[model samples]
Target: AGITGTILILGHTDPLFLRELLEYRITQTVIDKAHGIQLDAAAAQAGQIPEVHLKIDSGMHRLGIDTRQPEDAAAMFALENLNITGIYTHLAATDSIAGEDIAYTRRQIDAFNGLLRTLQGMNIQIPLTHMQNSYGLLNYPDVCCDSVRIGASLYGMGSKEPHKSNVIIDLRPVLSLRARIVMIRTLEKGECFGYGMMFRADRKSRIAILPLGYVEGLPRKLACGRGTALVHGRRVPFAGLVCMDQLALDVTDVPDAKPGDTVTLIGRDGEEEIGIVDVAEAAETLHVEILCRIGQRVATVVIDE
Candidate 1:
């Protein structure tokens, strides 16, 4: 369990590809959890094991076993055949010095540590501890012990403030979204565009259509949210509503608009670049979700280092 914990806790998010449809990867997280359970069971049967940790959810309410619920935590600890390890919790801002929210996390940490103390009172020999995240790692070294889980930091998203880490790190964004202009059409004044007839041409317009649509996960819910596109090295705006298998952009301003010109939807476009994070901001999501939800059939060309 210690070795397994080492593998995961120390593992950085840049390498842990989060494509949920990757069944093998999904199987691995589950298998590792099950393996922990089995290892505990074996140790309990032998009665020679020292300890293990139960990740407790004190407040943030995402992952972790419920330490506040003694029954739940105890049941998790009392796996058919294993010894209990230390208990750990996650603080929302164990790193940030924000406000009253910090107090809740403090209470959570105290509660989790208290839970460990209670288990010790029951004579459990659990060892190791944690209440930290990447931000916590930067701000609070106290949480660093036998192990600490660091995500996003390794990718150079190291801090919540500006001027955080100018030191270069070897991390890369593994996602890219793109589509090519498949056709071109000229729209006269008063002509409508796309479904719902929401957008009408105020003047004659030349629109370039790309072969990507809302069905490809190109966020249809984003109304007038504006998608970034490149035409002849100059970025142009999507003119009207995005539809399935196609999206229209006003390419009238483009110097040489034509069909079959490769356009960058979300990637480098000259010195003025576009990133998935930029797209996510327009689509109302984080870079994490944007990276995770790259559409199927879209080429994920991994340019190896």
Candidate 2:
């Protein structure tokens, strides 16, 4: 990966962090809101200002200056020390293919363009401009200015349901999670399991205890037989509620399941595989949410193949 490009700091610039960025000659950054004069002062101290990209709130109503306010745009551009090299806006909802949401996204695009024209009217020439996130990159590719910020798509996830992107790139998942069975036990037909006695063995069943639980980022909904794990190339259901640091799976069907055996929470095991989308659907959430909420207690390993 021979890439040489500046990383965009998505949040408000802190003075201390700005100083370090300046020291490292990092030139690209997005100014989401007014950060007082400290930002300019820091850049001035470093002998040159960064190529600042002004973020306008086209309709997201989150972290950006209102595009309706021309004064805000002018004031930032007028800063003698900083160079307004780019202007960008975030899309609120680009996943809606039709109706009000799509119409609203169009309105935001119009507003963003208007803001660009307003800057141009004042003789301010921003060399680069972009307003697309992953959804916009897929749906509004023709509206691209200078560049598009593709976030989730880079990780092989789509913005909409059905898990297929409009973009032609053949995307593949880059991350997979796995865990090991730590213990195994047999439960009587009438025996209860987990907190609150939420689940009970319908018959004599074998349970495999895993070193992972909701606290380790697995959703509790996945417990109580709602989710399944791949053990010995077969799907096995959870025995009961997910605990804080551990969970139990009904491995009765797989007689080979043992303490040292590996369990695939989300990855390939033999001929079977569990994907992020499958886990997200089981948790009733988005894939990104599932990935983000993975607890810090779990270790991570990166693979290139």
Query: What lDDT score belongs to each candidate, Candidate 1 first?
Result: 0.60, 0.79
Q: Compose the digit string of candidate 1's lDDT tens values, residues 1-305.
A: 13322223311121123332122212111112444455554445544442345666677676665566555555555565433434566777554555565576667766777777777777666666766766556655654445566765654443534333223344444445667778888889999887787667788888888887776777764434367677667878876787776788888788588888888877666766676656777888765566555578677666776
The regions of model 2 sitting more than 4 angstroms off are: 1-4, 23-33, 36-38, 41-51, 159-170
> What TM-score, computed on C-alpha atoms, does each candidate reach?
0.68, 0.86
Question: Top lDDT: which candidate number?
Answer: 2
User: Cα lDDT of model 2 overall?
Assistant: 0.79
User: Could you tell me which residue pairs clash in candidate 1?
Assistant: 40-81, 40-82, 41-81, 52-84, 52-85, 52-86
Q: Where is model 1 poorest over a 10-residue stretch in terms of lDDT?
A: 21-30
For model 1, state the Cα shift of residue 169 in Å: 9.2
